[model samples]
Target: MEIALVGAGAAAVGLLDALATTSLARVRPGLITVFEPSPHLWRGRPYGPDLDTVLVNAPPAIMSIRHGDPGHYAAWLGESGAAHLDDLLGQPLVPRHRYGDYLAATAEAALRTLRANGWRTRIARARVTGVERRGDRLAVVAADGGRYAADQVALCVGGGEPRDLYSLAAAPGYVHEPYPLARTLAPIPADARVAVLGSGLTAVDVVVSLAARGHTGPITMLSRSGLLPHVWQRPSGHRPAHVTAERVATAHREHGTVPLGHLIGLLRAELAEAGEDFDAFAADLLAAGTEDPVRRLRRQLRSVGDPRIGRRVLQETAHTVGPYAWRLLPESGRARLRRHFRLATSVASPMVPVNAATLLRLLDAGRLTLVPDVRAVEATGGGFAVTAGDSAIHVDAVVNAVNPPPQAVPRAAGELVASLVSGGLAAFHPAGGVVPADPRVQVAGDLAGGGPFITSGIPGIAAQAARTADAMLTLARDESSEAPATLR
Candidate 1:
């Protein structure tokens, strides 16, 4: 048997690690081929070698690629010493490129394990164009006219690039994507008056990176909501009492679906169990949406050591039980969440205390500004005119930091998915990702839909990888058992 994984990034790394560690791999040691055109195989677009200021957003406990093992990444960090301690968060927030190093090492280690178990493995540094069903097997077509046959395939493509909302890709001094800050930041003049689109984590990255690179001119973060991400508190290690994956699954099994109110009630119960006030906490979170951005950042930085575990509990369970609850939510419930999507995302994907300090400093110094209700950004004579809430501001450079919508297909993978859907080999999920029309072809990352409306973090991606590996192996085993003796 052969398994093909397309788009060798973080998801592919997780899948490969899963395949190597699972018991089923020993029973069915097959050839595994990974297809990725990028020179950085396991880093994906997010983790590729970049500026030192481009750091991992989350803590090590939640960044582990091995499912159920929260310490996997932290242990790796301790052994390698590739990370620096974020004293405020009380955890190591390594550079993105350093995290990429961990991924590459993990993939290499997983490949070694597979090889030791008699499973042949190779990475095809080529982009996959399409997947065609050939009888019971799959033919993975590559961009270089190379084709590989596999009994199973996993599409582990990552999320899409930042959206170019204002059609500024062709505009002078406009950066459509703010990644690999090392490259993107170099072209902009140090004193350029830069306007960064969106007020999310990516925008924070840009502002902080600019300061690190000695950028002195004014920087403005323009967005529709103008709500920056909540700052990460030192984790309280709070365990949920009522809000958990098992409870969510049980509720889904008992009731036809999980209502939004029911999920909120579970959260309330969890907070109550911790002797915390749900209403106060809820009101505080709500106030964040309308509160002054600089004031909020300053307040959050002061509360990094707060003893309250309400946010910590919610953050922990968001990935663990959130996915299960999302699937069980009625369309109305999902819509309601979508209505407050910006706020929810800001809470879920918070910034580290270190970067938050940088932002607060910039805001206090009047070097940075937050513009809300961004209407349009048009290229003007020598700069761009950004219209926000009835006010127009011009800047020399505009940086697109708008994150892609949840489950968005990357440009490179969109064609492959279209081919699969057109050929009836796969079906696209309305929520997101490609649903497997043929179970042999699975999905393992942000591209795999039917979940929450956010990109899967490392822990979530790891969980998906584990499930995909287990499902594919179980299917293979069942088929092998039912096969005729002559074929065996």
Candidate 2:
């Protein structure tokens, strides 16, 4: 079997690892090629080398690339890697680059296994333009006019870059993308009054990294909703008693589809079992986004050690049951979830406690301010004028920290997807991502459609990788049985 993986990001790493570890001795060895344009393969954009302050935002529990093996990453870290630990969260919040190292190491190890097993592996340093279905095979087209043939193709392209909402790409003193903070933040003056556009994790990254680099100028986190991500608490290791995937499947089998209220009931039951009031906690969670920013931060900080397991359950189930429950929900249920998507995201993807404490310090020290109800950011004579509701401020520089909408196809991949759609090889899903119409083509990572909109973290992507890898091997087995001569 000839396999082609487009985009050497986390998803590619997972797929490679899955293929290497799975029992494939029965199948004939084949070729596996990975295509990535970035100099850093397997790291993706998020995990690539960046400022040391750009730490891995999620906990080790959710960051594992190997599905079903939560300790894979932690074991890799070992006791010696604890130097990058975050005392508040009690987890090693290593730099993003270090996570990239893990991904590279995993990919290399997988490649070694595949090679030892007589499978050929190659990394093509080029961006994939499109995939065309040839006679009984697929042809992957690269930007440099290179074409590679494969029996199976897995599109593992990661998420898109931050959206330039204010159209400030050409404007002076505007940072279009706050990545490789080493490069983006280097040109920025230490005392430059800066306004980061978005209150999500990316925005938080800018503020935190700035402080770490001794950026003493006034900073503003601007957003329409003016809500910061909730701070992550120390893990309670609380597994849900009610929101299991099996229960969701049972509901679907009995009711034909799961209702939003049924899912809520499951959550309520889980919380009540932990001696928590569902309605009251639910109310607070919903109201948190609109409350005073500093007050909410302080309250969340105080609750980091509260010993309540409600948030822990929600966080754990958000990954495990979220995708299954989402696909099984009725249109009405999905619509209701979309209505409060912002709040749901805040709760689901919270910042680490260390970052939260940093933000609180900046706010209390009068170095940082949160601006909600952001109206517009217009380029001014000297810098930029940011208007948020009844308040306005001028900043010397503006960083575009607004995250792209979930599953927003990258600019480059957009053309590639269009080509596939035109060729009838793939179709776009209403929810997100391009769905494969051909059995030989697979989709993984943020690009896979029909899941929750909040982009899949490492765990979800890892799960998708494992599933895709298995499907590819199954295809190989079936092909071998049908045409024994093809294997030789």
Off by over 4 Å in 1: 79-83, 486-488
Q: How accurate is candidate 1 locally (lDDT)?
A: 0.88
CA error at residue 431 for candidate 1, angstroms = 2.7
Residue 228's lDDT in candidate 1: 95
- Consecutive 10-residue window with the lowest summed lDDT within model 1: 21-30
Query: What would the TM-scores of all predictions be?
Result: 0.98, 0.97
Q: Candidate 2, residues 1-488: lDDT per residue as tens digits?
A: 78999999899999999999998956789899999888988998899888889988878887889988988999988885679878888888989999999999999999999999999999999888998989989999999999999899998998877877888888989998788788888888999999999999999999999999999899999988888888888887777779988889999999999999999999899888888999998989888766898999999998887788777777767776797789899999999989888888888889999999999999999999988889899998699998888878889999998887777787878878887888888899987778898889898888888889787888778888998989989988888878857544
For model 2, the stretches where C-alpha displacement exceeds 4 angstroms are: 485-488
Cα lDDT of model 1 by residue, 333-383, tens digit: 999988888888888889999999999989999999999999999998699
